[model samples]
Target: MAIKYKVLPRKNPRDIAAPEKFYAAAIADGDVDLDRLAELISYQCTVTATDCYAVLHSLEHNIIGELEQGRIVKLGRLGNFQVGISSEGKDTATEVTTTNIVKSRILFRPGKRLRSMLNGLTFKKAG
Candidate 1:
């Protein structure tokens, strides 16, 4: 049996124009209403405004909660995020032991499928 695969046109940062431009053009074209356009974009992008905000909130809470307890949180296929201490003033090279002096950062690790897809495809410039 032949393997079936869906081929999506690769889009580069340069290939994409400003969202405002596209939105304006779409509105001018009258192909859809504002609400319909919003819904279409949301569905195609796998996220809506509400969903994005919720996800951001969840991530912030999870990371902060873990760090407060001195634990590294590992998001599957998205890497390990951690909070670590740093000293201020002249002793910038050393880590501070105090809980009050720490920095938080989010780390990401791409999944195998995502990595493979990235490696396998080459983006072509749209004329």
Candidate 2:
């Protein structure tokens, strides 16, 4: 199956006088929540849906716990996740503290397998 996208007309932010140009934007197929994901995984392996759900839930908790302790959580070929932050610049080294942090986000780096899967994707224009 191929990803579906549609062309959209968007104006340039830097040059408001410029004519709007068409851009391809991917249209989401649908959503698969945790319960649905566990069901799907069960079909592909020996694990039961209940077990898969439990493990996935545990995985989520553990990842957050590790990240809070300032550690990167690596999930093998699935990639790794770590906390990232944006902070205000400080003039002096001692002036910077947690108060300077403006935002915190979780960053995920896709592993080789996931990257290759993305590279192999085919796209179809949405009707």
Candidate 3:
């Protein structure tokens, strides 16, 4: 199925007074949460919906645990999950410490299969 997108007008960031340009932004048709995902997966495999849900739930839990331990979690064909940090610079290396660490965020890097899927996507203007 072709992805849907809508034209959106955005001003140039470097020059706020510049005329706006229109761009196509993709839109999601809907969301399929964990429960729905389990059912869909069960259809493709022998696992029951409940069992699949349990495994998915556990996977989510374990991924968080791994990330908290300062390790990257790599799920084949899915992606890699890791923690990223933004920090304030110190005048000297000796002055640098955890206090300089401003913020942290979870980052996802899509694996090869996901990247290929993204590259193959076809789009259509939204109705």
**What is residue 33's positional error in candidate 3, in angstroms?**
0.7
Each model's number of backbone clashes? 1, 0, 0
Q: Which portions of model 3 show Cα errors greater than 4 Å?
A: 89-91
C-alpha RMSD values across all candidates: 13.6, 2.0, 1.8
* lDDT (C-alpha) at residue 121 in model 3: 86
Please give the TM-score that candidate 2 achieves against the real structure: 0.85
- lDDT head-to-head 2 vs 3, winner: 2
| Candidate with best TM-score | 3
Please give, for residues 2-51, the per-residue lDDT of candidate 1 as tens digits.
22233344435675653422211111212554456556667778789566
Error of 2 at 57 (Å): 0.7
Q: How well does each candidate superpose onto the true structure, as a TM-score?
A: 0.35, 0.85, 0.87
The regions of model 2 sitting more than 4 angstroms off are 90-95
Model 2 worst lDDT window (10 residues)? 30-39
- Name the regions of candidate 1 deviating beyond 4 angstroms: 1-47, 86-127
What lDDT is reached at residue 78 by model 2? 95
> By the TM-score metric, which is better: model 2 or model 3?
3
Q: What is the lDDT of residue 52 in candidate 1?
A: 55
